[model samples]
Target: MNSLKRIMVGLDLSEMDETLIRYTAFLCSISEIERVYFIHAEKSLDIPDEVLESMPNGMPADEKLRASLIEKVESYFGPDSRVQVDVQVVEGSPLKELLHWSKVKQIDLILAGRKFHMRGSGVLAQKLLRTGRVSVLFVPENIEPRLNHIVVSVDFSEYSLMALDRILDSALTRPEVRITCMHAYEVPTGYITLGISYEDFDERMKGFARNKFAQVLERFPELNDRATLHLVKQENEDDIGELVMVEAKRLKADMLVIGAKGKSAAALFVLGSVTEKILRYNDDVPMIVYKKENEEIGFLDALLGND
Candidate 1:
């Protein structure tokens, strides 16, 4: 993603819709986003008796929904606006429409509401983030948006590198903001077979991860303090996600950024277990999940039938 100019937001007509729109407006201003599409999908645009009595006869449901969304967006946007806004109401599954429209519209980023103790657990937004081609930013229902400091979960993979690059190159990396490159490493259980002590191997792992981070710094010489390294040891297979979140909370990070890294669609998970666990456990601090730029597209992505 070269820039966050064109973006999209998915609305489900719930209380989350307002939050999503408001967050999107805030993002557009900070990022200098040129165009934004606010879309809502419905399985069926059929009107019931209550809606029918409120509207004129023969008024289409999609148009009515579009008008409602326009009003909501206008309330948030200023009159002297440089951003172009379009409200669309489409039929069929929300997930498919989000993915399809993201590709068709060439969206750079996606913004959606991340509900905590709200009506839903924000699973649909997570699934959409996992399945789409574009990057997704999940905003909570009740948090002030800020990008002063970002914690990026780096595994030294190309995807993580891409994410860090995009974040630094984008508007989020202001002079006042800080970026943390955190890597969690685990010592192999089979190290005993090599006559290596646990403490020694753990030290070696830390050194190795630090060396990799140093290589990254060498490669990007311009990133003086724009990026810094933080190493964490994984105590268990399933705790890396929690460790990342807790560390982010510890660092008082405004956002947690991670890139999806995996192979073909047939693989068990292209998003990886750590990313999945993070999505499930994260209840605070907005996260932006970046999809692999050059992924092997396959049949499994257009999945679950709904959003």
Candidate 2:
């Protein structure tokens, strides 16, 4: 599990900013986060000379934006927060600036707003998960700012283990917080070719999932009863991401955790199909897509000034 000592929160000055900032403060209070950077980006920092001259203190556009963001941060986090807080205003696309600055800071986790009915395209948050090497937490506009129960979407892949491991090792799992491992499985159509009945194949698939869960338990026996395995049967068009979200709703899960394709698609390093679907459909639950820091971003490393 990688320690999330430094986190970057992307702010676009929308109504989501309040939720993002307050939620960031909530996370900082719960986790071992050491530094938080609140960043806002603009397409251009250039202002007419007349407008600049008329400014009260002659502050640059970036500086003024920075001051406003600071007040917002201080309001939620308080002036004497033990965590070091910095507000940055940058030029260029918000998505580009966010990825670049997060890498530059070697940030551990990124908190981005998942807009439901916002003005922006709301693609930035999804793109960040797809393009960046860092782990990202998508905080929706409507959230309770509490994390009592976490649901990990598992396919028994390496990514699943990575997500579970991080949750198990993190300070966010303080005694009361529990982690649930949820897997969505389907009976392969090829089972018919193998002379297996649909019902038998379904049972077999579930048993295989249980065995995988047992392996997970063996790998992290410390998880013990704090985590339990749940396998859900997924039908055609049911969508694994949607199934996980449904399970989350049933469990009253506060946070959803899904792992990224690392060793398998290191070069591509994009969120898997299911993860992308979840990002699109989930607007009420705070979801985190976890990516290992050591994994290669492959071609993404040089993408659109990702450096």
- All predictions: root-mean-square deviation over Cα? 3.2, 2.9
Estimate, for each residue in 28-106, the C-alpha lDDT of model 2 and write its tens digit. 8898888999999988988565644534465878787677678778898876789998888899988788888887898
Note the residue pairs that clash in candidate 2: none
TM-score list, all predictions: 0.89, 0.90
Prediction 2 global C-alpha lDDT: 0.82
Give candidate 2's total backbone clashes: 0
Candidate 1 lDDT over residue span 1-307, tens digit each: 4377888999987788888888788777777688999999898888675864654456688877777778889998867778999889999888788887887788888888888777855677876766665788888888776778889999999989888877776676667888889898899998899999999999999999989998989877756667789888888655776888888899898899988764445664455577787877777788988876546345434453333
Q: Which stretches of candidate 1 lie over 4 Å from their true place?
A: 52-58, 268-272, 300-307
Which parts of model 2 are misplaced by more than 4 Å?
Answer: 47-57, 262-272, 296-298, 304-307
lDDT of each: 0.80, 0.82
Worst 10 residues of 2 by lDDT: 262-271
Q: What value does the lDDT take at residue 156 in candidate 2?
A: 90
